[model samples]
Target: TEPLEKLMPIDGYEDMPLVPLDIAVEPLVSSISGIHIYAYSAKERCKNPPADDLTIDESASIMLYSMDSKFGNKSLHVILNEILKSADKNKLEPWLLYLKLFLTALSHLPSTRRQVYRGIKLDLSKEYPVGETIVWPGFSSCTTSINFVQSELFLGSAGPRTIFSITCYLGKYIGNHSYYSSENETVIFPPTQFKVIDCLNQGNGLHIIQLQEIQPCFSHLHAPVFSSISKKPSSKLTFNSVVNHNTKWKQRGVTLTKHHSRGPKPDCLYLPYGVYVDDNQTIYIADHGNNRVMAWKYGATSGQLIAGGNGSGFNGSGCETNQLNKPINVVVDRRRNHVFISDSGNMRVVRWPCENGTNGEVII
Candidate 1:
């Protein structure tokens, strides 16, 4: 009895060291490239005649070698086979192919990930978020012979022969000469043409009026142009008077209430083109004349700076947050504590948080 073994030289040289094989009848298998191979066999058994059939171990070894050579030559074939097996289990073929192509073409660089994430976040935000709106109340014309009940209310004709009244809630026609006659008038009073400038709400439903002569200006002018009518002598008359009228009647011929002039004529009187009132009664005026928004605190007679106070020029946001470029109107959202400004010249709207004024959030 002998153990199964193979013999070969130490190297592929002809005169290399030779080793003896333990099993003499075993075949020497060689690859086509002349590389030597070995086969394992069992020793001959005298009693059982060494079972004539090929052993399972020898067959398995040969099959495994064949398979290893085939797979080693075509490595991609095995990979494809594995992928096919997985696809069969998952029932994914066409979709998997598409995904593979997509992944291949997608960004592979690590640096782009941040930019992509930011772009996606921005796109998602735009899909559902509601942006802010800035509104400013622009002064179109001077309303003399009118009364401002509150900062929000006005009672007077906007123009000659056009009597109207405005409250914070709504506006109504007192009487327009084009539509109503004297007999149709609700109250008996002299028919005088005047514009209501400001209104004061007294205890007895009494309101005062500041009247100035009217001078026409360009129809497109959003701010009151003093130069357009300054040359007219009739426009020089300034009357301060109170018009006591019931909610139902037109009252007249009342004595005027004088208000003492405060401060030495403002270095510059900024005629507010737009106004916004916050919860604290702080008035935000888009002073177009000053090219800035002025803040008049609740009890203060003078206005402080809010936004765009450098005499109307476009520049950086340093100390000029939410600078208005020819601002025309302003609206305040008391609920959100935000101010909306219509930067008409810039053709955009800008917003400012009511709590902070330095940084403006541009909504449009």
Candidate 2:
């Protein structure tokens, strides 16, 4: 019943334009055996669509199809998927526009990498081999829970069943926007390629298959790159909100970073209170948690200890000439090849030589 779990086949319709829902789906009215109750009610039903990349009408187009249940009979998901999974490629002509709109809307939703569940009424383990790649041409109907897939409401525990634990990389969860929010629906848009990790027959007419979604070596349908619909520019390095355009943050690969630890080690950084970037792109960090300053040359993995790595000033033995305590800020006096540190815990500013300084000179 969670029709929002459906996505159309986008293989050959890469060049199709994003027309309105009514005009896009008009070609199928005479041919397909279905009905639409929410035709043109996109604005009314989808008052708060998730993303801003697509227009309201564009977002509503997805919402309409997601909730549209053929006047209380067959769902748009079942109908649209039936055509998408069809072997006849010519049948896709009428659905090109709708497919374009559906794919574009799905492309706007944020991607979550986790395992999603899907249930089939029949055992399909024989078709998939270990280490083999498979492509699901149609939209994948999946839920976040295995219990939901096994429940009596969905594919019941009666006949032969195959449960797929799909590790989807770019899966979209549209359950909140669907008519059935409790289904915990998350879907994989087509033509997503998957590699079978393992397939096991668990006896009693039950089977389990582990699938990992992967980028295929070759293009399946030449899906156009929709860079405009993405939430952010594709970059290897993660960025916070409100990125400064003046900085070269959008560079292809990562530059300098510290994540999730304060370190006594050269590579680890914790609670960095200050940073200074030199003209040569070498970065100096006030590793506040470690009571030391670390300097990293451009593209270097680990940092070189600049000052006060022995211990903190307040650690029973008291401040040593070679030690620092709670250093808050740092600046490089490049003219004299010296580093000035605000040694706050010791209540003084200390100047240390960058090239060769075992102990800092109390300059304050």
Candidate 3:
């Protein structure tokens, strides 16, 4: 070992007091039953366990019970009232409880509405299994897949909230061969149906599930939306007439992409590749050909050069913050108040302290 006095400090290291092993082990030992250890990775939040995988029904039931457990009742109104009281008292439980409620709401439509609740399970652990059984209350063996949507842990609140997405089959079954016929025509349907379930976990016993019926389209999951057309009723038009109507649009096609003049000036942008806009309506553009990143404010005529605008060249790439070699993308971290750049040509990613800061530190 080298002399302690001669040792240089690391880039992100500092001395701190040592922690006692007993003190660290106290919480782990105290909550062993509730502590279902998950192998957390940088790539995933809450990965499913290999053995004894929890079903959608089990997840939803756990979520509902967790809500009831928190508020001591199943009534949402009472829960909301408790949350409001806690919030008024400046307590954190209400915020956490409300978040769980929000997560539960996203699981499915509320019980107040007219919904067809086919299967209901009081005991989730005994009722739900991994395969060939009822995965959720109204869903069963047809569960095709379970996907992870998003998971987040909020500070100033009690616990972490994790949400999962699941897809299952909801097949249609006919008891007899009798078919109902309409006045105009008879409609025959396939025997299989599918639905999507959104499951939320409060990192405790409470779990909530929201379910939505998946409709059959042209093999596409998401339905297309048209802004100009109304869903209720519309007038019919010929194919040629509709084509001609669309061609007569009088709006400016390109806004920011259009340039006032064509040159590598302070105002003129060249071969703009990646663009990102922050919450403040500030646009960060990676002008690849110019080898620079420009920060343009909303409605501004010209942008101020943020990084590497000193005449494009791979030779200009260096460890210096001002130097960038053909940047490809830019992202602004609003929380950290920093702008990150993908300096592709330099083969390294860099980030600036602020929007107008001079020097940037290489990150990746």
Highest lDDT against the true fold, candidate: 2
Q: Where does candidate 1 stray beyond 4 Å?
A: 1-268, 278-280, 310-322
Q: Report the lDDT tens digits of candidate 1 across residue range 71-163.
A: 335422233334333413242232232222111111111111010000010111111212221111111111212322122233222221122
Candidate 1 — what's its lDDT?
A: 0.31
lDDT of each: 0.31, 0.69, 0.37
In the range 243-322, model 2's lDDT, one tens digit per residue, is 22333444486545545364578887654556677777677777766789889887898889999888887632468878
Better of 1 and 3 by lDDT: 3
> Which candidate order results from sorting by TM-score in descending order?
2, 3, 1
Across residues 322-361, which tens digit of lDDT does each residue of candidate 3 receive? 7776576777787898878877666678887655777778
Q: Taking the candidates one at a time, how many backbone clashes does each contain?
A: 26, 1, 10
Model 3: runs farther than 4 Å from truth?
1-254, 260-264, 311-319
The model with the greatest TM-score is 2
TM-score of each: 0.26, 0.54, 0.30
1 or 2, greater by TM-score: 2
